[model samples]
Target: MIDGDDVGKRFAVVEHPMQPRALAAPMHRHHREDEYSFVLEGRIGAMLGDTVVIGNPGNLIFKPREQWHTFWNAGDTPARVLEIISPAGFEHYFRELGAELSNGPPDPQRLAALCARYALDMDMSSVPGLIQRFGVRFPGGPSPAPQ
Candidate 1:
């Protein structure tokens, strides 16, 4: 995905389908960069600390470095978003990790280790509900985090 040192300031545009499953970005907190995202269509629900904020089109969400956050499409339709990152090298992590997971299924143990290395932690209690709602599951284990 991204190399920690090479991330620089840049803008990224993405158009993702609005699927029913509640997608997620593994729990993570950046140590050196800040990120902002603008929704162009539909609504997105973001987790910033213990709060869940619903962001619709024209809404912007910000995550300062070292704050844990995650986001997902919250409505029944697809969404488009513009993601902005300050100090660009972080894209390497996203790209590399994405490529790694793009193949077949993900290895939960490996993913958990990777998340730990990146200061990311995911909660598993909500997982069964997620699967009930989304019909998706990770390949490795029920809870990937180290006990």
Candidate 2:
């Protein structure tokens, strides 16, 4: 695990452990950072714009800045990944979002403010279709297939 500061703000690494069929986030894009997800276990499915791709263990998936994208655990087992965010700072958004989520279902206004502060653009409406199409489950959404 590495922080942007440790890397002179070039990049930050965060480990994500996902439950079976879990959708990591709504379709979103960053204005200032690119993301690289390296699968460590199980399967990861990602949608970059209109194209969908899957990454298995040892595979890397790149999501460039300003591209609409979202990823999910595509298997009926736990999944793990290392996310590398370039040019730093976006990891703080994750930290803040985690805190907001810890307070139960987040207040929409606050969530929007958080996204705005991080230069993130999210399409909440795309969530349902993503869930349905991939048979994935967003947090607080339908239960995933039995593990």
Candidate 3:
């Protein structure tokens, strides 16, 4: 609910509502901002590098910049989390991504460019394996083959 500018760019708060079994994004890492997610409802499962952890309500998960990580709603019910991104800026990436998705499926090149602009690295190839291994659902239909 708080923008980076309002907080002098030290941090920004964004609320994320996750559907049951939803995977938030493909495996990815940020080069500029660290994120801390506080679980507000339901369970959240996250993978930081090769380590996996689960957080329930009242739990906070830390994801440092440059770490390959991803998180998903790990429950049968809806989930919500408050994300705090430090040194600001990265929250805008979510806004842009949402707008792109609103148009329909995103073009791979455009998505790549967007991520690059945000100093983010994504592993689209990891989607299928994550879905199968964790029983989570990626937003777009059909899993892409691992490259």
For each candidate in turn, the TM-score is 0.67, 0.96, 0.95
Ranking by TM-score: 2, 3, 1
- For each candidate in the order shown, give its overall lDDT on alpha carbons: 0.61, 0.93, 0.93
For candidate 2, the 10 contiguous residues with the lowest summed lDDT are 138-147
lDDT of 1 by residue, 101-121 (tens): 888565778767666665545
lDDT of 3 at 89: 92
Per-residue alpha-carbon lDDT of candidate 3 for residues 20-126, written as tens digits (9 for 90 to 100): 88899899999999999999999999999999999999999999999999999998899999999999998899899999999888999999999999999999999
- How many clashing pairs does model 1 include? 18
lDDT tens per residue, model 2, 1-147: 888989899999999999989999999999999999999999999999999999999999999999999999999899999999999999899889999999788899999999999999999998888888888899988865443
What are the candidates' C-alpha RMSDs? 6.3, 1.6, 3.2
Model 1: residues with Cα > 4 Å off, grouped in runs: 1-18, 108-147
- Model 3 has an lDDT value of 0.93
